[model samples]
Each structure stands twice: as structure tokens, then as C-alpha cells.
Target chain A: MTGERTVGERTIGEQVVGEQVAGGGSGTDDFYGRLRAYEGRAAVAGGEGRDAVNEPMIRHWCEAMGDTNPAYPASAPPTMLQVWTMGGLSGHTGGSIRSEAYDELLALLDGAGCTSVVATDCEQEYLRPLRPGDRVTFDAVIESVSPRKTTKLGSGHFVTTRMDIRAGGELVGKHRFRILKYAPARRSSAAKERTTEVKEARRPRPVINRDNAGFWAGVAEHRLLIQRCTDCGTLRFPWLPGCGACGCLEWETVEASGAGTVFSYVVMHHPPFPAFDPPYAVGLIELAEGVRMISNITGVPYDKVRIGMPVELEFLRVDADLELPVFRGAVA
Target chain B: MTVRVGDELPPLRIPITRTLIVSGAIASRDYQDVHHDAEAAKEKGSPDIFMNILTTNGLVGRYITDHFGPHVRLQKVAIRLGAPNYPGDEMVLTGQVTAVTDGTAEVSVTGRNGIGNHVMGKVTLRLSLDFPHGEADSPQRGAR
Candidate 1:
């Protein structure tokens, strides 16, 4: 299955180069020379993402990550920089635009017994936020390839690729990904034991700035304060500086009535952080004052925290230094 | 509020689960066998399916906005990975304000897992200056 998929993804130009390189037995100098030749060459040109920036994928990503920020529904998370350039399971179709140099580079590494590959890291700069319905196009280049180096993973070469993602012909973001293709090293028992050591982690502290300092102070006082626009009477939950309705900079704090319903919610089941238990429910609670805030929904099983369920505001003491506003839901 | 160079952003802890690995991979349109198919990953010399770079990027972006609020605009996020994020592991992401000028702030961020530092990088973001500053409930016009 892997062999078939690999061949199917390669371009005709690459297959020809693969055959040429396969017959030649080269020394280390020749191998390094050949590898260096591919640097600065285009790896992919005019590649298109299988799908445009859309809501479903964004929603799926947010659900998996337990992120409920309101800004995401309209604009995509900036870190999804490479999703638009992926070829997926079937690989790039409709005549691969992948450069022959890239194929030969990987084939050379595979022939040298550096068959295993792992993504080391990536860097992204967002020029603009991607919105739904934007068709993404990208071009990638072999940014660099490092000389052989020995590490815990064994001896291998590092390959870095840079991609520029565009929407409507306008550059939107740049992504640089580095991967190590290496031969697996034998694991020592002592090294294996170190992986099992667990460290205690605290719940992430909420970002407190001038705009939201008042909200945290309210939480400290066990009061749920909603920001009310003094001029327009519009209420906002996140405590923004200005009113979205009247553009009013004047606002006052109105203590929430404490009655609310679950507007939307997600059950977190994976990537358990140290401070949180698995399968817990995080909800978007709609206060009776008609504004929504994201918080943990307690007092019920994660599965039973349904939308529209009544919930009351309460402060949760996550640690000695932190007290968060969470909601209590009744079991149906 | 005025952002100082030494301001520290809150830390966030993320769980590493098989479901998150698979979901994140698919969500990012990365169908690499090593990212979702454990058997395929074993064939490639990995212990199990691992998180993809796109997912890490998404998480980092979320961590930034979660603190700076929804109005914060991300300008750049350049990160380097040191350790792999595998299932049954936890990653704690921490950040500090390194520089601030003309409504733009540069932050240094680090995400550490059990094995070691998983990611390290810098993020440049532009903060909206229109928000009312000082005395949370009082109106201040054109206050810097």
C-alpha cells in the first residue's frame, strides 16, 4: 500500500530522475554534492489545497483543540498556514507540479538508508487571516539541507522547506517546515524510562491586560461582571474596551443575574493537559443578560452538558493562585 | 492597559491524546500515514502516530489569541520544534512580552512536553489601540 501510494504521488519527471539515480553508486562526497544541488530549487509550484478555507474544517480543528474563541467563526486561525497546501491521502493529483529536484532529493536520502522521516518544527507569519471561501494556492522551495549530524535519533540530515500560501493571488502567509530523515537508533533502557516521568502542570493562566483586568478582579470577588455600554445599553461578555453597537468608549460593570443556559459546548477527550481531567465539558454559556462567555460546565457528566441546559455561575479554585468562573449545570 | 516588555502571558496546558492527534492531522488535511495510521507509523520507525506541524501552529495561534483577546492580529509566528508530541503526554505553552512599540508587541513563546521543549519561537502581533484604556468602567477618549 505504501509503495503504491508513493509511486502514485511522484511526478513523471521525478520517476525518470529516480531511475537515473538508482543505477549510480555514489560516494559520500558525490551524495552531498547532489543533495546540495537541490537547494533553492522549487519543490512545488502553483500547488492548490484540496479544499478552500471553510467553516467545517475550522470547526473540526477548534473542537479538537477545545478552543471556543468567538473570532474563529468568521476568520480562520492563523496557524492553519499549511492546511491549504496539503495533498492528503491520495497525494497531489491532476498532473503533479512537484519539482524533480525534490523527488530526487528524497530518493537520494532513502537510498542512503535515511528512510524514516519526522517533522522537526515549523514557523509561520500571517499576513492576513484566512476566511471561508478563499481558495488557497501555494509554492514551495527547498530552503536548505544541513550536513549529516548525529543526535539522539541517530545520524541524519535536516531538510527545510518554505512555502508561501496565497489567497486570490495575494500572499496570505508563509510557512517553513523542517524535517529530519534518519535511520532509527537503538533505544537504551535508561532513555526509555525517562519518557514515563510525569510532571505536574498548572492550568493555563488567563491573559490579564488593561482591558480585561476588571473581569479577573470580578472573578476574584466571586462576581460575574458583564460590560454594559453606558451610552447604548449594549452588553458585552468579553469586556472589550468599546461597544460594538454604538462605538461607545463609555461602559460600566453590571453584575450578571447568574442565570444562563448552555448555548454551545464541546467535550474534550484528548491531549489531556496536566491540570485538566479528560472527557470534561467546556461550554459557551449564554447569560440572561444576553451575552455569551466560554467556561467549564461542572455539576454534570461531560456527556450530559447539553445546549439550553440551565446553569449557574460559580468560581472554581483551580489552584492557590487562580480562581476561574465556571458554570454549574443540573443533571437532567 | 499598557503592555510592558516584561509582561508574562498565562500558560496553557494541552493534553496529547490519540484522538487529538488523528483529528488534528485530518483537520489540517495532512494524511501522512505516520500521523494517523499507527501501523504505517511503525513501518516508518515511529512509536505511534504523532501530531502534525499544522496542528502545533493552530495550537500556538489559539494560545496567543486566547490571552490577547479576539481582536489581536497575528503578524508572524516563527517556531522551531525540539521534541515530538506523542499521545499520553502533556504540553505546557508559556509566553512573555519581549517588546512593545506603536501598538505592536513581540512575544517569546515556549511549549514544553515530558521529553523536553517541544516548540520555541517568537510571535509578532498588533494590538488594537482603540479599546478604552485605564479605569475599566470609565470612558477615555484617545487615551494612550
Candidate 2:
């Protein structure tokens, strides 16, 4: 098969290898043409998820997002469409059905000095909810690759892959993931100097609407308010217009006693934002009234924050126009 | 419990912290370095580790269920991301019903962060409005 291919005086294999080594410049058009050829080719074929749809991952996701919807534990979250297909830290291993065309396409991009990569976005369509014990399988194709274009990061191409996720041989969902493979843009001296004059970014303002305006109003007066259903007398935090227990619309505000316990918490460490410092503790505070709210845990070091730790409500004046309700953990 | 076209669902405010970004990524089984390792992310020309699309999708799903109740079935979620959800930012998710027929509602959702719109798309969900009476506990109830 190798001997059969020929191009002019040289074999086709030799010509292909020579072209790859001669990367950009005159071959740029040919390079993109080769990339486009990968479109519709199998990226992953008959791939199996590292783990089945399970409750532990779902529970962990709910805890991280502060989502307590009971429907979980029964059925997996529809947004977890990609979770079942992930390869995890070790990445796709033995059972991986990865195709050579996909690898070759990426190598082509790498040879062109477009090494840095970042996921741009993804789209998902859930045909049905995934449940526990369902064996997940998928097959993906190289959907498309855009022409070389310069972006804020650098000059690169956008590669999109589409995957069909299935469980027990039945189609369950579809996912499309797009990424940019680019060469990092060099920073100019002027840009570096400007960055040195670092101006702190202001904290994001809270979104206050008709349903929760009264709660913020109470915070301005240094009071933590919880909404109580007028019909069922059920207490709720982060005010809602209707009662979840009884579906009552009428609600009244009650001043909280300012007492609470840390139900769960996480310490922020990476991806520093301008407004707040990192390594800070954010807690899901369960109030004495049985309602819970998310707030910053203060008056103690981040690592010191513990589950079940007692805390008191306090208003933090982040800036001139912004104030937030934070919890001050009891310092031992 | 009748969902009409043009009816806007209540907004949901989610605090974007480093913890949420990292934890959400891990929970979704996405071990991409850019979603958890700041140094690796910076090397790739990102300011820092940012939120993964799976996390954004999860948040969007949660926002919808929180409004329509836990019984709703999510049919589809198609989103395009703009600004990255960095730590210490807030993403306020707002949705409006664009079409409603045969017990299914199509909602156009937008998640805005401090920098700009983090995610914008549409969500199709089937709502069975037959929620059990007196079962209204807050969705934020501690799972412990």
C-alpha cells in the first residue's frame, strides 16, 4: 500500500511528510484544506464513559452548586450530558475508541505552532434523563473546523466536535464542544506597563428584583430577613414569591435572630478576581429558623471554617454603594 | 400553574467563586487543566482558571428547575459563552418563556457576569404542574 502511492518523482507518503514539516507560509491554504478534510470523520467511536451515571457525582454537583432539588438521587441532572463521557484525570485509556484522523488533525495544528488550546463553548440536547446504573456509550465526529483567523489570544482555528451519547443502546443526549487552538500572542511593552498600574475592579453588584427587593432592603437596615408563607407559616430564605410546600403566593418577612450554622462550605483558591481576595471561605449557612442562604464566612481564616460551626449574621460594606450579608464564624 | 408565552421566570443569582468553578468542573468529570489549574490556564493565555461549559449548563438547568419545580424535564439546552466566569464574580440568570404548547415551555436564558454575558441560549422543558400540595419546602434546603 505504501509503495503504490506516488506524486511526480516522489511517493505520496514522502510528499505528505515533507509538507507537514514545511508547515505554514506557502502551504497555509493546503494546511487548512487538510484540516477541513477531517470534518465528519470519527473522533471517538463506541467510546464508553469512565463511570456510569451515579448519585455520588450528582450529589457532589448539587452540593457545589447549592442545588438541593430532590429530583436528583433519582435521576441524573440533564446538564450532566458530558459527564458520562469524560475521560477524567488519566484521560481515555485502553477502552478508548479514539480515531487516528482526530489525532492527525490535532498534530497538524500543533505542527503549525498552534499549541495553546481553550474550550470555547458547547451545546447539549437531552433526549431523555439519564439514570443510575445506566451504561453510557458515545460516538463523536469532527463536526467542523474554521479557516485560520486571528483572535484576542492569537492566530488560530476553531475546531468543533459533535458527540451522540447513549445509554443501554438508546440515544439519550447530544453534545457539541468547540475549542480554539492558537499561538499565544506576545504582550507589548506598553501593555505590560499598563498592567503594572493595576486598578482594583469593583465587586459585582447583587441582582435585586421585585421578588427579593425586600430582603436587600432589610440588609440595608442591618437586619437579616427570612420570608414566611402567610398560608402555611413555612420559613424560606432568599425570598420566593410562592411557597414551595403549599404553593401559597402571600408571604411576610420575619427578622432572623442572626444565628446560623455552617451547613457546608468551600474555600476559594484559584482564578483570582479583582474585587475579592482568594482563599476565602464561602458557606451555605443554615439559619436557626431552618432556612439556608449562601454567604461569605468571615471573622475566621478560610481553613478554620468548619461544617456545623456557629456563625452570626453581619452586613459587610464592600464599597461605598455595595453591602452584603456575610456570616462571622465564632472564633475559638 | 399555567405557563403562558412571554411570561418571565424569576431571576437566580449565583455567586461565581473559584470553588464553584473548580468543584463544578470536577463534578462534571471535566479534568481540563484550564478549569482547575490556574498556572496551566495562564500558560494557555487565560487570565485564570475559568468556568467550564458543563458547569454553566448545570447552573442553567438548576435555574430553570428552581423556578418550574423539580418535576420539570429538561429537553434541550443550547448555549454560547461570551465572558468567562472568573472568581468573585456573580452570574445572574434570567429566563423568559418564548413558546408554550402541549405542556412544554421554551425559555430563552441569559447569564450575565460582571464582565459581560457569560452564557446565552434557550432551554426547552416539560412542566407537569401537578406539584403535590403542601410539599413546598425551599429548594435551598440543606441536603444533609
* Top candidate (lDDT): 2
Output the worst ten-in-a-row residue range by lDDT, candidate 2 chain A.
Answer: A4-13
Model 2 chain B weakest lDDT span, ten residues long: B132-141
Per residue, candidate 2 scores C-alpha lDDT tens digits across B98-125 of: 6665566778888888977778777888
Model 2 C-alpha lDDT per residue in residues A163-263, reported as the tens digit of each score:
99999899999888888787776668534533442345578888999999999999999999899999999998778889999999999999999999999
lDDT of each: 0.79, 0.81
Q: The CA-based lDDT of model 2 is what?
A: 0.81
Each model's TM-score, in the order given? Answer: 0.61, 0.61
How good is model 2 by TM-score? 0.61
Give the chain A TM-score for each candidate: 0.49, 0.50
